[model samples]
Target: MKNIVPVKWLLARLYEPDIVIVDCRFQLGNSNSGREAYEESHIPGAVYLDLEKDLSSPIGEHGGRHPLPDIAELAARLSQVGISNESRVVAYDDQGGAMASRLWWLLKYLGHEAVYVLEEGFGAWKKAGLITTADQKVLIPGRFLATVKHNMLAEVDDVRESLGKAGVTLVDSREAPRYRGEAEPIDRVAGHIPGARNFFWAEGRRPDGTWKSADEHRERFAGLEQDDEIIVYCGSGVTATPNVLALEEAGFTRVRLYAGSWSDWISYEGNGVAVGDEKNQ
Candidate 1:
């Protein structure tokens, strides 16, 4: 709940000048659908930020499917959308906060500490009779700057070194089937990094598609020590962000994101891959 805001919380501050709302709705294969959806109807005054366009850089040989965008370019884009350093940002998506969390993580990494993810998806907002508009608002550009946080990320080498090491937990945020190598819908590799434990990212949310409480999140990660160094990853880097946010909500202080994730791990020939349920160390 620390970095998540409810619909009511957003509703009251909808028209505020300093509060900027971003729509981060994205579907993996249908990239254009997100933009089209936003154009159709969205929360009034919300600007659409595409995942493939704004959040990630072009794919390379090693940086996985969705590489981190260049900080300066992203900052310029943020400024164009009127997001300054003082802006209180609220990002939302219909995909259970998966895409929204990417922006949330990126903003935090950029050292903008006022960013938060919307608790419920956009559909819930429409169902509750909240306003939705097709009109786009013209915005004055802001003076946003980037101050990258290097400590929030874990490179492939950092993960490789942490393998089988004490006081470090490598969490694979993919589904059970993908983690167990039963089925891989995306990515060339079918298995996970060796010694990584599976913790599906959607588990952080309740059955109703809303996020769980802080105590509930703590229970989800009860096996993990608060002091342990937690490294979270998914197929690419996108879905892993929810787990990163969840860990923080659970009161874990040492969480870091493996931005390249499994796709990048297997891009190298020498990396080890595991195919079954591994015991949590």
Candidate 2:
């Protein structure tokens, strides 16, 4: 299956027993908003996955705002939601896959590659005149074994060591204002990692909210060599997953996610931060 599936394609296979649809809509400020939205009306048979509750562990001072959940716990949750190793998982959110991609990346990190993000999210689904249901479906639990892929994730120390290293590229997937240190609505630090380059995650999407073609992504990321060790990060590591998908779609195989991202970086007192533009580097 493709990394991104459209609403029409998904609608055709809605009743497939092997398919599990996940509603990932979330608001960073209001933690309960996503669940409320899900309760109101979501795609038929779509289970809700809360970003703070299901996808991540409680935040400590060191692990950033959204640390990954324990592998065992995540696996159990997947099983409870009727997802098995062979399940074709489709995740979507109101935001342009920012929250949904976190689940997508988490599934991949757990060695489950049969996952795809819904193109254009829930709004697109509604716009396409697809059916939305408020009735919750009771699912019989399935066994899902989790195997963590360490290579897919980059810890804080790993990102620290990669700074200014030859053949390594640290990408700040936040918007330009945050990367430039002009504004920081979240996190304690107002700047970014010392040597990281900015690549706004929204750039990967078109005005209609669908992802750019693979060829377009290749052109956008042309500066980096295919073999470069690329690490992507954003505020709390949620939004950055879209860039991870974009990079993979562009045919770069050596991509890793800085799971803690900027929030974790600033937690260390000694880690240096850079302000202004890349020209200042």
Candidate 3:
């Protein structure tokens, strides 16, 4: 499956044994937050994946706060959650595809093409008048054949090249403050790339946290040239995914994620760092 699926499509597959639903609601500053919403209600039969507990590895100074987990370990984790190569996985969260896209990308990384994200996520599912369930089930383990998708990731070297390449658009998906060097909540240095534009990933979603329509997304990103290659980044790589996912939905053909992002960029020894509107300077 592609990166996104309509809620109606996923609803039809809800009861099929070949499908697995995952709830990925997360509140960035509040560690104990998401589960309450999940416990309060979720898509029927969905298993919850916690950002702090399940989706990421522990933080270290040298590592981004949300380092992508080891494939072997992540494979094992998926297996424990009853995900198999044959299973079609659908991940969703309250926010656009922020946390959900992480799992969507992870599934692709694991070579599972049957995986997809709920286009507008759980928020839209509920608004469609679907019934919610408080019944979260424990999954039975199943083996998965893990295969990593290497090209989906943008390395530090890729960003370096993008600085000099006129055809590439390095997009910073962090909030305007962070992108403008007005704030530095997660990383030590407070700055953006030498020539990166601000996309403000959250703009793709509504106040309720569901993703907007593809047309709306296309309009928001209308400032960019269609032929330019896009590389998206946030605090780490986690938050930027919704922007990448949004671009995908908007009909942009070539978009990639900077897996290490600013966390990896500024911290590297001898790497150049810049603050404030670096988009043209």
Candidate 4:
């Protein structure tokens, strides 16, 4: 399954019965803002999925700020929104591609291989003078059974086990400053996991908010080999999915996501933290 699709590609398949367009726009602090934006104007026939409500479970002591949602519950929600196992999901958001990628990752984790993120976000879609709507479209629910893929996830213990390992490479998807311990905005602690390399997730996108090509994505991770096992994470595991998607786009097959991420790492008392630059490739 391709990780991304252009706005026009979605535009052409806009009315397809098997296609389900998702609006994933979200703000970290302002939780209601995403759905508010969707209610105001959205791509026609699109259903809204909130990052906090739909994509994540309640934040626990050890599972990071945005823990992965319950598979059964999420599948039910998808069913309610008319997303079945065969639905060709195209998720879009205004927050770069983070929120949309979160959905893409979740759907893939559930063994729904037909998921994709919009290459250009909602902002770009409106800019192109494409169709938009405020009216909510109703449809009958579809059966969405989730077959969870355990291998695609990396728990904090898995991350700890991979530290300094020869074949496995841990990639911190946060920005350089946060990885360097210069700032601690969201999480309780700064810095990153020990022995993890920095690969800022935003680097996957261009200045205009469009995703880079596969060759460009390959160039971004030129330091990494295609066969190496890559584990990616960010603040609370939300932004990291884009890097995971990019890794797949670049043809890196052995990639997994540390879903708890940095926030969950710091939650444990004995977890080691590292500062300053490590190998950045």
The estimated TM-scores of all candidates read 0.98, 0.98, 0.87, 0.98
Instruction: Supply candidate 1's per-residue lDDT for 257.
Output: 98
Summarize candidate 4's per-residue lDDT along 3-31 as a digit string, tens digits: 88888898899999899999999999999
Select the stronger candidate by lDDT from 1 and 2. Answer: 1
- In candidate 2, residue 76 scores what lDDT? 98
- Which candidate number maximizes lDDT? 1
**lDDT tens digits, residues 1-281, model 1?**
78999899999999999999999999999999999999999999999999999999999998999999999999999999999999999999999999999999999999999999988869889978988999987988898999999999999999999999999999999999999999998888798888888889999999988899999999988788899999999989999999999999989999999999999999999999899898554
Candidate 1 — which residues are off by over 4 angstroms?
none
| Tens-place lDDT digits, model 3, residues 123-195 | 7888899989998786788889798777777878888888868788889999888988999987888988878
lDDT of 2 at 61: 84
As for model 1, its CA RMSD to the true structure in angstroms is 0.9
Candidate 4 stretches with Cα past 4 Å from truth are none
Cα displacement (angstroms), candidate 3, residue 202, comes to 1.8
Arranged by lDDT with the best first, the candidates are: 1, 2, 4, 3
lDDT (Cα, tens digit) per residue for candidate 2, span 1-281? 25999888899999999999999999999999999999999999999999999999999988788998989999999999999999999999999999999999999999999999999999998998878989988988988998889999999889888988999998999999999899999977899898888889999998878899899899988777899999999989899999999999999999999999999999999999999888335
The TM-score measured for candidate 1 stands at: 0.98
